[model samples]
Target: MAADRRVAEGLEHLKEAEKCMKTSFFKWKADYDGAASAYTKAGTCFKSAKSYDQARQAFLKAAECNVQNNVMFHAGKAYEQAGMMCKELNDLNRAAQLIEKAGHLYREHGVPDTAASTFDRVAKLLEPTNPQKAVDYYLIGSDITECEDRPRQAADFQKKAAKLLVRMGNYDRAVEVLKVEKKFQIEGENAPEVSRVTVELVLCHLARGDFVAADKAYKDAYGIPGFTESDHCRELAELLDAYDENDQDRLSSVAARPMFKFMDNDYAKLARGLQAPGGGEGGKKKKAALLDEGIEEGMEKGQLENQEVGGEDEDEFEGGLC
Candidate 1:
């Protein structure tokens, strides 16, 4: 009871601070710094009062004030704080959005590393619910990392984006993103990165149900020096051979083989879905149907788990057809 009373008192103080912040904003023209200071005070009070939602809003208001004053660096920090509060509230989409705002501000302020890192976090947050958005954030991060002369980091982000693209059945886009991996390759040298990218491209093509393109990607990767040195690479070669020969039995055998354990789950799931009865026979609608069935199944499983754990249901966010 005492704790509740203390919280109520703190909330009253926060409300007073918020009123002062608003008065500073409207009554004093060009006093953005004063308003920002008031907003920060209000945010602190909101935090003390355990009003996280209000705290996030107050910090965002401060960020807006800083942005209006062209103090973008400070504004970016404020936005990051708001994003952290959103994370604490378990509002991942909102957090990702806030962080993305911070990332843009940081980039505009010439803070490449911070911008890249912020965008990476945004991508990670969006990955489970909105993979296309995740891919977009990852690509942005990759661009920033590449500009910072970090090819390996750039390739890593690009690869992650490609993986999501493949899962979303945007194989063409996946291939395009994976091509960025070649930027890390040295001329006239055997680079494992190059082979790795080619293998991913093969998977993308296969996921798109394009055996011809998959064959080309596979052969290209297989011809690379030291490609077969890796056991996994050899397995990929055998899989490609099966695909080339149009041998359904061999394809199924290889897909089921433990040697393919290194395959990404998204790739495996997509492959299984495509190979199912009447799968890959129709056009985009057919693909969407398959995806919907999988989504429904997943939702059912998630609901069951939630019931078992006595947790509130989480909202689902679906991305557009890739």
Candidate 2:
């Protein structure tokens, strides 16, 4: 009676709006159940009167009255609220179960993918005690949708799974997971899926430490702007022809090959610490660092005056290892 009296007093001004909504709701009754809405309005009025528990109970009754009417959306929302209430009461397991009910209803309504992903959120609450179960949910999250509907969906979930697999040392499976992300299984031959798959395939190849395979993959990935700039591709390029900083003689001698420019390899700074001193690897590094700075400084002397040979072809360093 107290809750009802508060609701009545709070809604004294909006009785007409409430009736209009009730009628509108009835007119759309077949598509959406409008009968249980009385409790919803009463709950709103109770909430406005600061009677929170009473407001919550009214919403619960509204949900109960509608669940028999097949209004899955309202039932789902009820589960969500029940879970919220359970959380405030510090009943975590019951709270998790309530959220899970909403997740299940979401699946029942032609949105299995969204449901599976939603379940992942709840699964996280249980992951510390149940990681393998989390992995199971993660895999299911990947499988609930067609690769064609939201094509990147598979890749996104699979990539997450692959990280877990990496922790498990399932490298082969991880690569395979990456491969699945490369495809549009339902797409036609001329579709963009082919190009997208090619980029994904490149990432898989790079993971295996095969430079030749990576080179081919890089070619494909480079065609896609995001892939080309990715850390994975850049790291693979570094490993394919990693320079030996300890071998300065080889680095500076006539047979020494030119290396990637500093801008191209961000690690050029760290690699400096490993080089031969003075001339061999070490001297070449100092020389390189000095030249880098010299080139940057504003010089009073002209290029011709500064050149021992020319700015580009100065005598290479020879003896600074010790």
lDDT string for model 1 (177-278, tens) is: 877765544332437778767766776777677878877766666667777687557767777666655555555666766644456787666444434123
The most accurate candidate by lDDT is 1
Please report, as a residue range, the 10-residue window in candidate 1 with the lowest summed lDDT. Answer: 273-282
True lDDT of residue 125, candidate 1? 82
Supply candidate 1's per-residue lDDT for 229: 85
Worst 10 residues of 2 by lDDT: 254-263
| Model 2: per-residue Cα lDDT over 1-322, one tens digit each | 7766777764552343344344353465422244346656665677666665655565565566568678877777666665655555556676677777777787787667657667677656545655555556566666765433665565556555655554454446655765565552323232344343443343334334344664665565565545555654555345333322433454323122232223212122222322332334544665788898887664634555667466534334343443
> Against the true structure, what is each candidate's TM-score?
0.70, 0.43
